[model samples]
Target: MHTSSARDAARIRVCHIVHSGKVGGVEVAAALLQAEQHPSINYQVAVLAQLPDGEPQAIKAPDCVGHGLNNPLSVLPVLKWLHRNAPDIVVASLWRSVLVGMVAKLINPKRKFVIFLHNTQYKNVLDRAAHRLGFRLADGIFCDAPATRQAMTAELPLETGQIHVVPLVARGGRSRHTPEAEQGPVGAVAGGEIRCVFWGRLAKQKRLDRAVHLLAELNNRATVPVRLDLLGPDEGELDEMLRLARSLGVEQQLHWHGAADWGRIRDVASGASFFIQLSDFEGLGMAAVEAMQLGLVPVVTPVGQIAEFTSDGVNALHFDSAAPVAERMLSVVGEPPMWERMSAAAVAEWSGQEDLSTAFETVCRQFLANQQANAANHVIRGAVS
Candidate 1:
């Protein structure tokens, strides 16, 4: 991918390589960082795959080099493209992108490599091997969460100083927990329904079917009328989820929100009493974190970094299955004081978090300085020789 600004002598160019040109959490994070990054740094993206029609645009910022390879077989072309327009630094995101980035780095050893480790688990064996290779080959690593960094350190034989943990923060941050504009009038009651919100891709990893069953159990076993506003794009599993909800007689109670934009999600979150997700596992659980920062009580599974921040009855409730999840749900709804206390704790958890954009900038600057020092040392050695 060519960054025309790279030739401007005053600019420092960096590019992020990812598997797809779709609007997912990582893509959103990259877009946010590109928009908020230092003006002198020229940022671009090399999407490894061409996303299908109707998919959200991967790169949101203007003047971006959206390099999407049409097929996996075109690996040579991708490498040639990287070699032709080598950025000062290339950040590889996800396991697949890591593989591509490692190959590109081998072909063009002059460019600095940074692996963006976002997932704690790489399910594919070959991908996992490639991920480790990329980590070992990179000049630095940026972990999405502390837990992710710990996993990499424990399993991969790598230097600890090369890894940096940067926890992601939601946009539109505030000083304290406050009511959102989309929320009902403070303490207002309408139809006595408890509004629950869930956001993430509609796939098996999310375990949203668990959410449907939990809602049914909550409605059947408790006094509160529970309704879930399931937000996110369907990844070929929404049909099965709807069927399961219908079989359990919860079809009417479920609200299907298809791929809501960030602004719309913020509004929905403002009015929600609790945000719930029981994903099989999460790398960082950014969606859940966003909801918690909005002052919504979290009913999340103890997965990934979620367990590090949320306590069972303090900041968030834990839910592994239908029975226990319903029990916790009812407990939160029945006791207003209990949830209020949890809400305060939840806000406190994210109260003093450093802006994620600033964290990214800090790492980029630190690594850039290292790259320069290494170059200078090589120059000195050359002169001595």
Candidate 2:
């Protein structure tokens, strides 16, 4: 697995490690990096957990290796694989992946490890410790949002030079048209029926119950038809959300469409008038970004990097998660002009900067350059020592 001097000019092997092969921000980003084709670099992916049966049909990276590691002990197999393959650089896309990458680097100190911080979740002591250890062991840190980078520096006390802010690459697809380009329903339809679409796992962290309650509140006084479409896998939280919607007497207005295929999901999102994301926290709101790209006016809280891509009055209608979300939703639904402005801005923003190919190439190039420099530094240190 040792590198040959003659191979220096050839493609450098880079491996991306992720916790799961499921559809998420981190996984999508890693897939994009792996799928990128460049003359100077070759990419591979290793997933810690086995992808769900028939769930990963959408992923196009053929070289991605699924280790089927269901637990911490399963990481040993990954370590062995890494030892044999000996990637010039390893990029860990999640916390668990970062831990595994750090351990792999310890096994071979010459290996360069770069960690991508996808979210901001440093609440407990153990989480903080793991984050610090990963920061200290990795050669560089890549962050999608400013908040994530800030959290890393605060917790790890790393020098600013070691932190890199690379925005997440958008999923490639047709650019969604602006409201004017849209054929019908340019704004919130009259009669107060605001069609809001929410797409994500129905997990506790997502706090979809809050959205249900908001719909209930809106139904109390609103004359317009306010409908909410819940799209995602039906986890335990789905039942609870349904109960909440019923209790709020908005059951008739709420539609539950279980997990949809990517194409179907995009079609559903593109047809929606508004997109609502009520998650308490997020590393990067990929669904929100996708919805915005499709001309859906985003009504999201300022959590994670949602604010990074969206301006309060420019592209989205930002709301505090703790504030009167339902009341605000009603207000927006009642004002078609405001909705039109926000929807137009949302489409404009996505069209302007959410180009997946460009963003992916930029991050890949930066990562490869960093890895080359780190490899050279390791060689120099070894010679001196």
Error of 1 at 301 (Å): 0.9
User: Can you write out model 1's per-residue Cα lDDT over 139-162, one digit (the tens) per residue?
Assistant: 888888988887766665554346
- Residues 161-190, candidate 2: write the lDDT tens digits: 456777663552332322244422223443
TM-score of each: 0.83, 0.81
Error of 2 at 327 (Å): 4.5
| RMSD of every prediction | 4.9, 5.0
Q: All candidates' lDDT scores?
A: 0.72, 0.68
Task: Estimate candidate 1's alpha-carbon lDDT, on a 0 to 1 scale.
Answer: 0.72
Among all candidates shown, the one with the greatest lDDT: 1
Cα misplacement distance, residue 153 of candidate 2 (Å)? 2.4
